[model samples]
Target: MSRGDAHAAVRRRVCLSAAVAWLALEALPARSATTQDATWPEEPDPAPGRGTPADQAPIDWPEIGLLDGRRRAPQSWAGAPVLVVFWATWCPYCLRHNQRVERLFREVDPARLQVLGVAVDRDERRVRDHLRQQGLTFPNTVDDGGLRARFTERRVLPMTCLVNAQGRVSLRIPGEMSADDVRALAARALAG
Candidate 1:
């Protein structure tokens, strides 16, 4: 081969190697960020007469159906620190958080805290099957009919909101959380 041809081949090989490395890195698990400020998207001002808190207004829980077929209304979250987590079965990050949530439920006292999982899957049957296969015993809600419209409006996902006993939203974290993170958030919510 000519000298020019050899150099071009070497450059092509380098580009291919870099692309492969990037894909490999993308496949790895993500670390939990301490703050979700940088991750959550900004919300637009509400139209006239909406009369709602910007952050809390965008979360429509009632539209989502809990595992027991009951609507996940605000009343359901009353008298406990509710951790409403929006996730999907296909998302790896979401799956990882699901495992962590299950562990938290097993270790933590339910009387003091509640963890609610909202699956964004379009197919309710598939979601139910997956939940059964995984042995996820906590209350899970499925967001059908684009019930996630509010959450999507805020550009949040794998998101979690900490609701106080009064049914008021306290904190919103817009990323994956570990078991330790759940415990810490619960502790703070209970203390308050």
Candidate 2:
């Protein structure tokens, strides 16, 4: 074959190969940007200050309740740095943070800081039994009416909101947090 013809044949083969590769890639399904099996870091990266805006009013806790039980206000958080944690007994991450929370309650002065658990589980008996089994002494309010709607409007479990002494939400942390993160948030809230 002529040199020019040979070169042209090679170019045609290369183009066909490139087209096949592009077609194969296009035929494959696209992967989701978000991952379901993402491994969370032991120490979460520094997050932005996603706190409640100053214009947002403080959440009224008393207006919320336990399943079929009387709704009562949070007495412990009155005029103190409050940690309002929305968790459930069924969530593994939530259960893991329970011990950390208990330890924080013991270490931190209750007069200066208070952690109130808000169980978002639909079943109150399960939560109560789990808390009792875990020997958790902190005061907890049940969200039978799904009071989470009043919080950050996010439907994620194990969300924690640090409320300052001035009754303002200073930080809203979604998902599990390490003990250090909790302490840092508590210290910030107390200092503020």
Candidate achieving the largest TM-score: 2
| Overall local distance difference test of candidate 1 | 0.68
Candidate 1 lDDT over residue span 1-192, tens digit each? 999999999999999999999999999987546333233343332334433333354244464467767665655556777777788888777777778788877877877888888887878888888888888878887766364454334445587766677665556676677666766776776786
What stretches of model 2 exceed 4 Å from their correct place? 1-52, 63-76
* C-alpha lDDT values of all predictions: 0.68, 0.70
Give the Cα-based TM-score of candidate 2 against the true structure.
Answer: 0.65
Determine which window of 10 residues in candidate 1 has minimal summed lDDT.
36-45
Provide the lDDT at 4 for model 2.
Answer: 100
Q: Candidate 1's error at 152, in angstroms? A: 7.0
Off by over 4 Å in 1: 1-64, 68-74, 145-152
Question: Which numbered prediction scores highest in lDDT against the true structure?
Answer: 2
The C-alpha TM-scores of every prediction are 0.65, 0.65
Write candidate 2's Cα lDDT for 1-192 as tens digits: 999999999999999999999999999987532212123222321333433345456766555554436555656346887888888888888887777788888888888998778898777788889988887877677776445655566666688877777776656677777676676776777787
